[model samples]
Target: MEAAAPPRESRPGRDWDRITAIAAVLIGLAAVLVSVYTVLLQREQVRAEVWPRLDFYYAGVDGEFRVSNKGIGPAIIETVEVSIDGVPVRDWAEVTARLGLSDPGQLYSSLWGAVLSPGEHLAYLIPSGQEAFAQIRAETQRISMTVCYCSALRDCWLAAPEDDGQVEVDACPVLPPERRFQN
Candidate 1:
């Protein structure tokens, strides 16, 4: 048999090289995951900062029907819908006429395209006298209002008298001219 060759020398640090490469890859992957999670958390924090809430209130004693922005952010009113006995009315004037309160001496504010800052309120309808207040309060059972508003970030919600609370919406519906509330 030929003389045995001198024992071949094992390469130094061969195993350590593979281990180091795998560790580097794992570390990079972990960093990427952490960065993605951080981005998602920041996005959520931004949304919460500008979130808005709109609420409807009626003060029979004060003869006022108001809409308030109860959240920390401003509410941009998109649409207002008022109905009497399930029939849509174009304005507070029509509502008074339907209620048989001719010349109710109402002071009203337009709701369409209004912007209410945090804690701000708009008295959409205020009757001038006690008699009108009593009549309006009594007939409130037959009236309903639905309002749609958006936050500064464009997140929208629908506030309805019949709903338990406001409902989130992708966007506000576009009402026909006849169905649109002028006030």
Candidate 2:
């Protein structure tokens, strides 16, 4: 019939459908990126919380001992008590692992030692040429050292001995490298 006059030509472009599909894809991608960013931030925060603050190193020589403190804060290595292989000394302290600051050409003559500041270092010198009560072999003997240091940030604690009397450290970072004599 003449009234059917051609149903209005169906709209030519599917623009609305295309636009809706594009928006949906963009929203999904945005959600995925946001989730990934959140996960990475959380991982970084966890790693920063668990790191230890101090670094301890040691070295041995025929008569002197070198103890290094590679820590962020100033450290006081008070009274390094040395017992070889867990055998406590019965008489006069048989071991002499002393600490001191050293220069490029010579060692400081101060009899006692104290705080090692950041980047600044010191060393422990065991008086040279003395017959040790026990044969001090690098592989067989160890230095069980206890250091009492107060952190610049106001925390004080005693460090436990790393090696329970087994070997000696020839170079301690707390002291200058020139002062270090590797054994």
Candidate 3:
């Protein structure tokens, strides 16, 4: 009779190989997750580098009202709304006429569709003398201005003379021709 074959021993190597494969898969998954996190962080950093902030400047002594881009990026003025006693005015002429101020022959710049670069300013309204300035400043108590602007990345903000600072907005509202400020 042939001798019984020795019982085959369990192969420990096979178990080790299975464990190693599982470990490799886990490591690969972790690497992919980290890569995704890194990419998201980089995108936020880029947005910050191009963020824009628009600031309103009112100089009673200088007789000027200006809008400036104080951030590192450019600001695209989308719409400018000038109101008196909560009523919208179509243009600077209307604002002056309503305020009962004679045209002082001052210079003014358009705000709609204008782009303001960093550190650049646009004098929206400039009175010719301190007398006009004083009158306007006094009457300005009842006046309010709203400017909606966007950055290169399409991030929008609403700035006003009354607000302490600009407020982030989802988007600027589209105004009709009659409601839009002409200057």
Candidate 4:
């Protein structure tokens, strides 16, 4: 029979092995907790960036074409450039001339503003008579516009028909800039 091997001596760090393993597990758990907390904070940041939607659209009321804002937040208008039939319009006079809106001067004369808040609207009442409105409607075609605006936070956006029915936003600081029109 072979002689039995001598009994092995206990190593100095043998007990430390269990302690090191426990420490490693605790460190891993702390790392996971940190990652989870950071994710939660990021989610809140994303939510903050996506609110207060602003938009522009047309509404017909009492035989009038109204330009209105339908957003929850106030939109500080930076510019309002409208083109009809591929021609840029500076003022209502140009719009009247280009649209051939016969005898509809009174209401159209006062249409000028760079800023529009939610639910606030500007109207261009089609001349008092139905017959006059008919002529303007037939001649109006291919209306394109670019309304550059900003939020109270200075978040800029462009409300354009060419965006496939969507709003374009940018973080660039465009505030304190000259507005294209006066209210």
Candidate maximizing lDDT? 1
- Ranking the candidates on TM-score from highest down gives 3, 1, 4, 2
lDDT of 1 by residue, 51-156 (tens): 8887777776787878788898899999988899999999998998998886557899999999999999898888887778778878988888889999888999
Show model 2 residue runs off by greater than 4 Å: 1-64, 85-93, 96-113, 126-142, 160-183
lDDT of 2 by residue, 1-183 (tens): 356566677778778988999999999999999999999888665533321233444344334444444545565433333344564432113433321112222232221236666655344434333333123334233545444445443344445446423222332224333322222
Better TM-score candidate (3, 4): 3
Q: Once superposed on the true structure, which residue ranges of model 1 sit more than 4 Å away at CA?
A: 1-15, 162-164
Regions of model 4 farther than 4 Å from truth: 1-61, 108-114, 124-129, 161-164, 171-183
RMSD of 1: 4.6
TM-score of 2: 0.36
Displacement of residue 160 (Cα, Å) in model 1 is 1.9
Q: Superposing all C-alpha atoms, what RMSD in Å does each candidate have to the true structure?
A: 4.6, 13.3, 4.0, 8.3
The superposed Cα distance between candidate 3 and the true structure at residue 48, in angstroms, equals 1.6
Q: State the local distance difference test value for candidate 1.
A: 0.87
Taking the tens digit of each residue's C-alpha lDDT, what string does model 3 give over 1-183? 999999999965568778899999999999999999999999888778777887777876678988788898889989888888889999887888889888658778899899998899888888878787777878987898888999888889998877758889999989988779988
**lDDT minimum window of 10 residues, candidate 4:** 174-183
Error of 3 at 171 (Å): 1.5
The clash count for each model shown is: 0, 19, 0, 0
| TM-scores, all models, native as reference | 0.84, 0.36, 0.85, 0.56
In the predicted model 3, the residue pairs found to clash are none
Summed over model 2, clashes come to 19
